[model samples]
Every structure is written in C-alpha cells, then in structure tokens.
Target chain A: MGNVAYAVLSSDEQEVSIMEKKIQWETELVHALQRSKVEKRPILLDFHNPH
Target chain B: MDTVTYPQQSVVTFIEHNLIPLRVGSDTQPLASDFAVTWTPTLVLLDPQGKEHHRTVGFFDAEALIPSLLLGLGKVEYDSNKFKEALGYLEKLLAEYPESDSAPEAIFLTGVNRYKSTGNPLPLKEAYEQLQRMYPASTWTKRAYPYRLLG
Candidate 1:
C-alpha cells in the first residue's frame, strides 16, 4: 500500500515487485485480479474461516 | 494463519517478490461459492487472467508454504503451456526444498512437465525411479506408478 518497490531478477526484465513491510492483501477478487494482470504475477487467493 | 504463518519473514518476502495476494473469508459470497470452497485456510493460485491452477485446503508453516507456492506457480505456467517456465519453478522447488512435504508432488509434476516438453518417456521413467527411491511412501509415487513401464 505504500511506495511500490521492485527488484530486477535479470536483464530479460524478469523484475519482481516487492511488497511493503507487511503483505498488503487485497480483500476483493476484482482488484486482486487487476493487480495480478498488471503485475504479471500469480494470485495467491486465500480463504480463511475468519472466526 | 494470520497470527503464525503470514507474519513469517520468509513468507512475507516471498509473497512480496512473486505473487499478488488476495485475502477473503470463507463466507464471502459468490467468490467462495464460485471456488467451491467448503473449508477454511484454503489457498488457491490463479493466473493473471484469474483462472485457478493450483489449490490446497489446510494450513502450512513457512517451511512448507514456499515450495507449495512454487509448485502452484509451476502449475500456472504449465496450464498456459509454458513448459520451460513451469520447469524452472519446479526445479527451484526441488532444488531448494527437497525435504518439504510438497516435494513428492513437485517430483511428479516435474516428470510430467518433462515428458510434455520433450515428448520423451525417459524423464517419466526417471521421475518414477527417483520417487520410488526417495519418497516410496508418497502418494505421488503411486500416482507415477505406471511410469515404471516406460523403459
């Protein structure tokens, strides 16, 4: 949620975006999918009981 | 999960580096029903287009979780027919976390991916042999049981 940080993996531009100090987890699927597409990364969708 | 697993430094870094994370309650409408999730702590890996490639129902510690995610990433690539990319992730998982519970399945997928990419049955045979020798009790070994005849 803060400044977006990035680390380059190689010259082929396999750069990865680094999250904030803590994981900035999106609560909605639509938004997360948007980020997934933009970031070109997979989505780790987690479902918890929330009890 | 919230208190224990997510806060781990390694997990945080790994997720930050490789994945887009979405957190939802099991009761969240439509989403939960769409995914057919009947249990808590279920983790699913989806491609950028939102197609699910891998999923696990249960909890995992930091040690086990990373390899599982790698496997999921490999599956995502595999689903897209990017066998070489998938193999990269699988190879990383096997090399780095060989002892993790996800290892057997990684070995299984590695074999399948190798076969898919190379059209050669030898890798399948090798995968079965490796699984038999290293993880004889693993269900993955049994799943690859038929590959023993691929000589």
Candidate 2:
C-alpha cells in the first residue's frame, strides 16, 4: 500500500498548488499600475473597506 | 470580498488571466480620489493606460464579476478601434451571462461596434429592440434610445 499512500500525498500537493494559484492581491496601487503597463494588462482595482 | 467572493477559483483565475489585480483600501491616497470611489467595495476596471472603463459599486459573486470585467475589456478594445475584437468579448459576455449587470452595456456597445464597422443602422435597431425587451428600465436602454430613430 506504499504506492497508494504516495498517490494520496501527490493528490494533496496538486490541490494545494491549485489553491495557491488564486489571485494574489498587490497592495501597492502604483506598483500594480506599473506592472500593468509593463504587462499590457488592464487593472482590476478593488476598493474595499477592510473593517 | 476576501472572505467570500475573491477567493472563488473561477473569479481568481479569470482576474489573474485578464487583469492586473490590485486591492486598495478606501482610504488609500490619490488613487481613490482619481477613481472617484464614493463607496466601499467599488470595483473599477481600468485600461492599461489608466482610463476608467467600468465601475460597479458592491460585492459581486464570481458569476457576476467575470462578465463585468469582460465588458470593461471589450470597451477598452472598442476605444482602441479594435471593433472586431471588442465585439468578440461583448458578444461572449452577452451569450454567457445575459443576466449579468454588464449585459445592458454589452448589448449597447455591440450595436455601437456594429454601426462603426458596417455603418448600418440595422444592428443598432436590433440592439435597441433587445434592450427594450430585456431591460427596458436600465440606463443602457435609455442610452440606446436614440438608436431607435436611426431606422
């Protein structure tokens, strides 16, 4: 059953990676804008109350 | 947003693929005033050049967010004179999420693109009809009211 255990661990790792792929929020608006200019991607600015 | 909406896989994936996601607090400097954000949870989509394309004030589930962003992207393309590409995104948004908040805007822009492309009033008439039928009370329908006079 050693192979089975390894398979289960691999599946968990893959799931973790997928979760990690979720959008990373960049806090610095200026830096994000700069990156957007460099990357040629539109900016999705989410303004919200943290409280 | 962090606890509910933004964490959704589809929302995250779409944003990461199509946008440079930035989170700013309401109190954040010049950016907030520049964007004219008067409420919390105002999601603004801007072109790479920093022009505001679309803004929605409130929380949006993944289902709602994607189409709104697509509409903004479509407008950016439209503003850049990429009519065909803009239509592609707008049409997709309408097809996939006709019930979305952005649907009216997409419908309106689709007609504008069609008119820009062929210089014909038929598409605009059809768009006007669709808007009247689907969202008669929406501001988009009101905005498109003049198109009815074209034919």
Candidate 3:
C-alpha cells in the first residue's frame, strides 16, 4: 500500500494530527474519538496512547 | 488549496524535505493570525474549502501531532480524563523543559483545548496569563488579547 498520512481535525482542541500510516493513526484515533464522545466535545488527542 | 495531496517518499527523507501539503506563505504574520499557528513547525489542517479546521504548532514529531490531528478531524470527541492526560504531559513539558521552544505554545494550546472541550475558562485564562507573564513578547501573546476566556 502507498504510504498514507492520516490527519485528524478536532474542533474543541483546534488541533490537527498526522501519522505515517492509516493503521497507526486509526488505531489511535478510535481511542481519542471515543474519549471525545465521552467528554461531550472534542478534546486534544492523547497522542501517546499505546493502542 | 482546493485539494490536498501527500507525495509519499521515505518518511525520513520526507521529513528532511519538509514538503508540507498546504502552500504556506513566506510571512509568518498571516499564518499566525488566521490559522492560530504561532510556532515555526506547525501542522495546519484546513477544511476542504481552505478554512482553518485545526492546527498543531511546534509539535516536535509525528508522535506529538497525530492524536491532535485526529481530534481536529472530528473523528474523536472530548474526554475530560483524556484531556487531563494530555494536559499532564503538557504541564510536564512546561515544568521539565521550560527551555523547549514548544513549551509556551503547548501551554496556550492546552488551554485552548480545555476551553473548547470542557467549557472551562479558568485554564484558558491561566494559559493567556502564562504567556503574558512569562513570554509577554511571544507571538501567541499578541494573538491572545482579544480572547476573553469567560463568556
């Protein structure tokens, strides 16, 4: 697969993130998205999440 | 500006080349103001219409930028606990690495995130105050005045 750069845009944090691959970014993105759902708005990404 | 493209090469080489997708201007003022990009190495996420979606300024590496990017994309929602986790790290960066170029911006950004996600004005106020007190001359401070933390 071609190298994919995954970018996530969060409104609450007003921040953007990019990772080298979709798998890597998506894995982390899911955790963060779920957290955002819980928190009731978008928050900063926990970029260091191991999963 | 209408479309986005990523020219994939060796990641390390691409990092070396620093080929950002957006067409950045030579002058720092516009980028800093319109997009909230206050630091040199910023990753700005523009909407398809080219409006600012979210921006990560001065993150040292992808590790620091990716999660923030996810948040910007609307793929992630807010989590107070998670925000706290990120805030902890940012605070650590400030306390442990005061000399780091990204420290001040991190503080301000964290405050911005806190406000947006949790509607907490106090931390955002602290962030503005921090820049004013410690780095009064910081570019972020210049942009901070109009921001009234309280509704």
DockQ of each: 0.53, 0.59, 0.03
Error of 3 at A3 (Å): 47
Full-model lDDT for every candidate:
0.91, 0.87, 0.47
TM-score of 1: 0.88
TM-scores, all candidates, are: 0.88, 0.85, 0.36
Residue-by-residue lDDT tens digits, candidate 2, B1-151: 7877787888878888888998888888898888887898998878777788778898877888899889989988898899998999999999999999889989999998999999998889889999999999999999889888887
Give interface RMSD for all predictions.
1.4, 1.3, 13.3
- Candidate 1 per-residue lDDT, tens place, B28-105, comes to 999999999999899999987888999999989998999999999999999888999999999999999999999999
Ranking of all candidate structures by their TM-score, best first? 1, 2, 3
Candidate 3: residue B139 lDDT (0-100): 84
Poorly placed runs, candidate 3 (over 4 Å): A1-51, B1-81, B148-151
Sort every candidate by lDDT, greatest first: 1, 2, 3
The best candidate in terms of lDDT: 1
Among all windows of 10 consecutive residues in model 2 chain A, the one with the lowest summed lDDT is A1-10
Model 2: residue B116 alpha-carbon error in angstroms? 1.8
Q: What CAPRI-style quality would you assign to candidate 2? A: medium
Candidate 3's TM-score reads 0.36
On residues A1-51, what C-alpha lDDT tens digit does candidate 3 reach at each position?
379887656864453234332121222334434543454333231122111
